[model samples]
Target: MKMKRKWTPSTRFMLIILYFEFIKETITVPCPASLHTANDVKRCPRNKLEWNARAARLNCSSINQTCVDPSLFEYHCVLNKEGNQLLEVCAPSKHIHEQKCTEFNSFGKLIQASVINCSDALITCPDAYRSTEMYKYQACYDVVYQSTRNEEAHCSSRSTEGKSHLGIAVGLNGEVKCCSGYKWSNRTRLCEKCTPGYTGPECAYSCIYPYYGEDCFKECDCQINLCDHQLGCTPVYWFNNCPHQPEYEEPAFTNTWKQRRDFR
Candidate 1:
């Protein structure tokens, strides 16, 4: 019943980036040759156009220059403790042959914030992180994967998050909760109805007899398919309110009875 912060070291909370952008950063996709923030990357003075900043990718990554190899343009995205703001994008020193990436741009007065040493999953979920907006979980995965290739190590699912939301995937929408097992649909950005053949909190249960679909919202016709037990019994001939109700009635024989009685 205790609440926990979804971030470790607190400073990592600054990296709430987009999903695609986060993936690009983790893979070290070099910045484009031309940038709105910095021009002339296409014609670098030192052939160092690969030394690009992460902020350019904060919104967009469209560019002409091919992404440089991480071996060639490795950099540490530093964070300045100056109120949890991004410090600098410092690349490998031409002198240091080893690959110990420096964090802060200057690495002199600034403290080295670690990209490792913490699992974001262990942290408490922020409003934005809980909903997966701004690629919250993916950002954590990027950092954790750097230390250990095991992606599951930093997965949010491993954490016991706001279960009180009752499996409801958070988002900007006012939707409070959803059934268990089913997550918020990335495309729709909403907790869609349970998938066909699944129902209940998180959509863990399967559709019985008739209901089917991503959320089991569809109703089945009793002809070839059986009705769902929840919909009540659908006897074989019960269509259109029993259209043949009078067909099996016994016929009256008053004329024959009268004739037979007169003869007797």
Candidate 2:
């Protein structure tokens, strides 16, 4: 006996369904030529073309991981995800910055010859000295030094008095010498000229002229009047003139003489 064929709903569905799928593996290409030097890479036109071709072979995510020679046309090399090298030419570095010196000297001025190193900075000494006068010295920052033998001798003379040899000697310890155009006065520490109304050392005392009392406290006694009642009189003009009394008649003497003669 022949068997009867039966069709189910799952069988009909399987017969009607048809689908297709395809997959391809990623590809990586090697760089065409090796650029030995920056100059060689720049001169070759194939360098740029091969660089682009290598970049195209890489994945989109990793297209910037290549190394190029900086000296070669200022270009940058980038790689693709497939590990291919690329070259990108860029412009040279800009000249927007410049360096400058910290100090300058004028014409006809001399600079010193020295090197000073301080902190992180370097300083060069001037080529010539600023002043060539006698007893002058160079002053640079914290350091002070005498420039000549005369200055050194002057300094030694000051040292004997136990004073500094710098710009100016100060305090009570320094003595004023006549050679220095000054006379010492125990009272004032500064140098001064003799005042018109005063004389002697440091002009401490007043000159004897129209002034009379000590330190010229008393003014001249040349007033028009003979005596000054306000300050009493001096020995030279002590007594004032006396006033004369009024004259009277002589009537008593004649009667006395006549009475005496009659008694005799």
Candidate 3:
């Protein structure tokens, strides 16, 4: 005794659209933090499929690739689980070289004075004061082979006894502080010996047009604004065999001659 609802063409089309949307939501791939940035797609094959193919052809695999640029954190090529497509992964670098132990005080002391590896790791000591013998609680390790091995660095009063002129050192805040004579380099992670014509703590200052030597101490002897850092202004006459002209003279009337000939 109730009237049945009739299905219209428009209603059926809407139902089909909703069904596809549900399917898409259920089939999405997962992205990992170690592989992609927040703004990027949260799954493998972050780049265009074409680009990944090119990278794979170049043998850019994760096993052999390395990140050397200080600006970029890491990068490598990888393949999806299906092994039919390759993907390139990259991340930004971070300032994490100075790592503090979990249980140590700011002054580099243990909170509970527990045994090695029992309480907390020790502070990373200077390279000069690092222990030759291996220990379980040391916080230092060689720059290479960090994953497979870890070594401890022992600290001593001698660590603070270096001469300022001898070499660069790590400051109290773990920043690369230059010695008395050296300058800090913005292009590098440590203090550097600035080349000639550059100055300042950051070694970013350069000598102006006329100054050319270490610390801009030497001045160019050539024409103004024309002097070069390595080679100064060129000579007017470069040929050794070129004839020298006589000095000019004022023309004057002589007895029978028209005038005195000028020498040039």
Error of 2 at 6 (Å): 99
Q: Which candidate number has the best TM-score?
A: 3
**Please, what is the TM-score per model?**
0.17, 0.14, 0.22
Q: Over 4 Å off in model 1, which ranges?
A: 1-94, 105-107, 110-163, 166-264
The stretch of ten residues in a row with the least summed lDDT in candidate 2 is 20-29
Q: How far is candidate 3 from the true structure (C-alpha RMSD, Å)?
A: 22.6
Model 2 segments beyond 4 Å from truth? 1-173, 176-199, 202-208, 223-234, 238-264
What lDDT tens digits, residue by residue, belong to model 2 across residues 9-124? 88866655522111101111121122221111111122334333323332222323243233322222211112111122221211111111111111211111123312232433
Q: Give the backbone clash total of model 3.
A: 2
Q: Candidate 1's residue-wise lDDT over 1-264, tens digit each?
A: 999867765456456455555554343322433122221110111112212322223222332234453443333233332212222232321221122222332324222323332233444224211110112223433342233223212223211334322234332343344434355566654555554556544455454333445454554554323343344225453555544322333446877787889999
Ranking by lDDT: 1, 3, 2
For model 3, the superposed segments whose C-alpha errors exceed 4 Å read 1-176, 179-190, 230-264
